[model samples]
Target: MKTMIVIPARLASSRLSEKLLLRAAGKSILQHTYEAAKRAAITDSIIVAADDPRIVAEVDSFGGEARLTSVDCQSGTDRLAEIALMHSDVDLFVNVQGDEPEISPATIDAVARLLATRPDADIATAAFPILDESKLHDPACVKVVMGANDRAILFSRASVPHVRDGITPAHLQASPPIFWQHIGLYAYRRDFLLWFATQPAGRLEQLEKLEQLRAIEAGKTIVVTAIESSPPGIDTLEDFREFVARIENQ
Candidate 1:
């Protein structure tokens, strides 16, 4: 199947304020994310599905392909849907958010491979085992509950796979974890991408503010693969500062 990675970039962000355009180590965050996505060995096609001409210009500055999508698109997936319509030849489209400059190419490849390998799954995503007790309960850390054989049962901001009894450190150290922190990276089949765009907002999705839940509520099978934890996306000035510090230190 032909696979391509599409990054949805918008100039306006509530949290960080045009954070994708923010420069770190002399490169914009979107450019860093685009560069990282290009590192995946399985595929070479990559483009930014930008919401503004400014983002398109930025992509052009780096010789990266970009298409201006509607700013009114409901979500990043919706932005990808616009690109999907333009590229009917692509069988698989990977949605990599622009803010995720630290997104792992291995993780991107793994998610794409999972969808390719599993005929029953409609989508594939990555998650990391949550080993820290603090992170497990930190409502900010979204959790993934696995179902039968790689299927995801649910995604939640609250702690899940509810260990009814008191927990211990032993549980955290298991070969396979009982809890996993959901990663934002995703791979979607062409049909699934179009179908997702048509679906209405789901109740669970509305409550959790997680778009993946819309697919879950629609009964679409989603598979989750384990990957190394990637550094969190840039969300605030502090996150950008941390990224700058890491790059300068290196």
Candidate 2:
């Protein structure tokens, strides 16, 4: 399958203002993410789908390919859809968020490979087992409920597969994890991207603020790839400071 990685770079971040342009270790977050994507074993065809000219310039500063997408795009998936329209020859388009500077190449390969192997699935995404009860309850940590054959049943900000009787260590330690934290990474079949762009956000999606639920509500098959763990993306000033500290220590 012909695969391409697309980093959706948006200038207006709500949580942290212009977070992608924020520098750490002498490189902007977008540049770091692009460089990480380059290290992935998948096809080297990568592009930054930017909503601002400054973002395009930043990508160019680092010698990375970028195209200015419309600011009217509601979500990163929408941005990817615009790119899909232009690159019809690409079979699979991977959505690598521009904020994820520490995203693993193995995770990218895993998600892309899952989509390539599962013809029934319209999308493939990564998730890690959530062992901490606090994190499971935290709305900030999106949870992925998995159904049979590694298919995602639902995604939500609320705790799912709810321990009706009350939580237990055994449940958390089950062979097949009882809880999974959804990673932002996604791999979409070209058709899926085009289809997603045409549809309106689902009721559940609007409620939970999870874009993936829009697909699930539409009866789309989404496969989940289990990874051991993934580094958190930069969201707050504290997260950025921690990222910088990690880089300095390294």
> Which candidate has the top score in lDDT?
2
Worst 10 residues of 1 by lDDT: 159-168
Q: What local distance difference test score does each model get?
A: 0.91, 0.94
Q: For model 2, how does the per-residue alpha-carbon lDDT over 1-250 read when each residue is reduced to its tens digit?
A: 9999999999988889999999989999999999999889986499999999999999999899999998789899999999999998999999999999999999999999999999999999999999989998899999999989999999989889898999999988888889999999999999989999999999999999999999999999999999999998999999999999999899
User: How many angstroms is residue 247 displaced in model 2 relative to the true structure, after the best TM-score fit?
Assistant: 0.5
Q: Which stretches of candidate 2 lie over 4 Å from their true place?
A: none
Candidate 2 Cα deviation (angstroms), residue 68: 0.2
lDDT of 1 by residue, 1-250 (tens): 8999999998999878999999988899999999999999767599899888999999999999999998679889999999999989998999999999988888899999999999999999999988899998887889999988889999999888878896689888877788899988899999999999989999999999999999999999999998868788998999999998987898
Once superposed on the true structure, which residue ranges of model 1 sit more than 4 Å away at CA?
none
Please give the lDDT score at residue 248 for candidate 1.
Answer: 80
lDDT of 2: 0.94
How many times do residue backbones clash in model 2? 0
Residue 125 displacement (Å), model 2:
0.4
